[model samples]
Target: MKAIVLEKAGGPENLHVAEVTKPCIKENEVLVAVKAISLNPADVKPKYEDEMLSMMYGKERPVILGWDIAGTVTEVGSAVTNFEVGDKVFGMVNFPGIGNAYAEFVAAPEAHLAVMPSNVSFTEAAATTLAALTALQILSGKINKGDKVLIQAGSGGVGHFAIQIAKNFGAYVITTASAKNKDFVLSIGADEAIDYHTQKFEEILSDIDFVLDTQGGKVLENSAKVLKNGGAIITTVAPDLPEGVKAAAEKENKTITNILVHSSAEDMNTLKRMLESGAIKPNIYKTFAFEAMADAHREVEKGRTVGKVIVTI
Candidate 1:
């Protein structure tokens, strides 16, 4: 099997295309012939020194990095009841662990795999795994009809999905993005798009029922100020709240949650329904060939991609 392997967590140069041994499936796993793989912010952890990576690389063996994949099941273990040979499947495979999705084949647990939407292409399905799952999990049951929700980094992968998901449940969604992407965000379902470059979001939006904070740091700190009493906040990064936000939330009685998305077939079925009904759509910002996996990682590292970036195998 061919794979992009990383020997160390340092630079894109460390990632290279190589022929590696094919992975074998466990009793509870399925062997997927990965057709397309998508990149995320987590894939860039190697660029920073001493940063705690959500995914680990093997020091002795070549580490394959990636979690989102849309592929076909070539073989299934005896315990795999939900999927079988020739099944088109997609999911975030083994997230928070060794997903090893950046390859021609991957051994995915049955629980982490979902049947691909029949109407969606492999590339589109691949684009929706981890990022879409994050958005779906964070906003699921966290907001309701007529509620006002605020999402940060609305033009990025998770942000884009969050905006569409919030709107699906009839929530009025406000989001922050660059001036260049303001119209793009609105077209995708955001009711209001605040240009983070020139305007202050906290000053303009108030009494938000939910705040989906994709950008951490001061963004997380200032999110509390815009929420109404008892409003809730969910951040994708930095589980801990800054002292200022904590004080504001403590005084105002607002709730907070930090999102670390988990894999679920039920949630994937929800996405399947959305896709089939044309409720939520994927915005693939870019696509790279299998040999260009390093280039894809470089693009994601810039942190400016408007949506998902995928590599076709």
Candidate 2:
């Protein structure tokens, strides 16, 4: 089997395609012949940091990085009954840990896998897993029609999905992006697009019901100012609340919380319904061959990609 392998955390130069052993599955897992994988900013950062890799991937040599995958189930475990050998499935496998998806095959737990919507292609389904799930989980149980929601970096993978998901819940989506992607973000359902380079979002926007922060640091901190009293923020980029955000939120009677996305079959199936109904659409900015994993990483690292970047096997 061929897989993209890495040793030590570093740059794109550390990623290499090599022949490796195929993975075996436990009774609760299914073996998928991977057809597509999505590249994300998260995928790049952890691989370049030793501490993160050790904590996330468990100090494994020849670490395989990636979580989003769409493929067909070629083999099913003895305990699995919801799927068979020929099922087409996609999901974010074992998030907050190694998924080992950047390869020709993935051993995913049966519960983590969802049946792929017939109307969706493998590439599109592959791109939908991690980013879409992050967006979905972040917004769940917190939105109502006509609520004001701000999603930062609206052109990036999670941001794009967040915009569409926010819109589906009837929220008024406000987003931040560069001048070049302002229209693109709006076209994807953001009711308002703030030019981050030319405008300060915190200064102009206020009374938000919910904030989804993808860019950490200043962006996450500033978002605190706009929330209405009793509102809440969900941030994925930052490990903890920005230095003073918690205090400010407390003062204003608002809430700020950090999130790490987890894989859920239920969420993926909900997205599948959205995909089939045209309620939400995935924006795949680019797709690369499996051999070009390094190139895909480089593009995602640029922070300018307008949607999901896919690597196809």
Candidate 3:
């Protein structure tokens, strides 16, 4: 198997393509011939010096880092019941073990895998898993017909999904993006797209039922001010609840939350159904060959992508 390996935590240069041994499947795992893989912010965050030294390498176990994968199951363990050899599947991989998905093969637990929809392309399936699930979880609060919702970074991977998902549930959605992306975000279902560069989001929007804050820092802080009382502020970035959210929630008695997206097979299934029904689709910002995995990561790190960036194997 040729994999982009991170032998030691460092910069993008440390991620080099090399021939590595193929992973062996456990009794409940499926061996996938990875057709495509996608990048997320989490892929780089865990490799930060403080995080790696304190949590991962500090434990004496070097790890492979990939989470979102879409591929074909070439083999299945004896205990695997949900999938079989030659089944097309996609899902987020279990972290810290065989998340070596930037390769030709990956062995993932069957419970973590879902059948890929026939109508969607492999790259779209690969890119939608983690980011889509994050948006779904963040916006899980009450959604009623004609209700208003806000999505920050609406042209990015998670934000695009959030806007579409909120719209699917009959909510009017507002989103923030660059001036260049305003039209793009609105076409994807955002009722109004705020240009984060030219104007403040809080100044133009208010009385929201939910706010999906993909950009944190002061954006997270400013987002809270625009929500109606008791409206939720959900974030994938800012692992900690932003102090502004906490302070404002304290002052006005609102609810704010921060979540590190989880890899969920069930959510992947729902996403596939939505795609097949034409209710949602991944907006791919770009695609790279597997050999260009490092470049894909660099693009994601820039934080200006219009949608998910995929590495096709």
Q: Highest lDDT among the candidates is held by which one?
A: 2
Which is better, 1 or 3, measured by TM-score?
A: 1
Model 2 score (lDDT): 0.90
Off by over 4 Å in 3: 48-50, 53-62, 95-98, 239-247
Residue 287 lDDT in candidate 2: 92
Q: Please tell me which model should have the higher lDDT, number 1 or number 3.
A: 1
lDDT of 3 by residue, 1-313 (tens): 8888776667777778888789888999999999999898877666657455446435443455688999999988999889978899999887434466778899898878799989988998998888888888776655677888888888988889988999999999888889899889988888888787889877878788777887777887787788888777777766365565587676876677678767677777888888899888898998998888778888888988888999999
Q: What's the lDDT for all of these models?
A: 0.88, 0.90, 0.81
Candidate 1 per-residue lDDT over residues 88-142, each given as its tens digit: 9999988777888989999999998789989999999999889999999999989
TM-score of candidate 3 relative to the true fold: 0.93
- What shift in Å separates residue 94 of candidate 1 from its native position after superposition? 0.7
Q: Candidate 3 — what's its lDDT? A: 0.81
RMSD of each: 1.5, 1.3, 2.1
Deviation in Å, model 1, residue 51 alpha carbon:
6.7
State candidate 2's TM-score: 0.97
Clash numbers, per candidate: 0, 0, 0
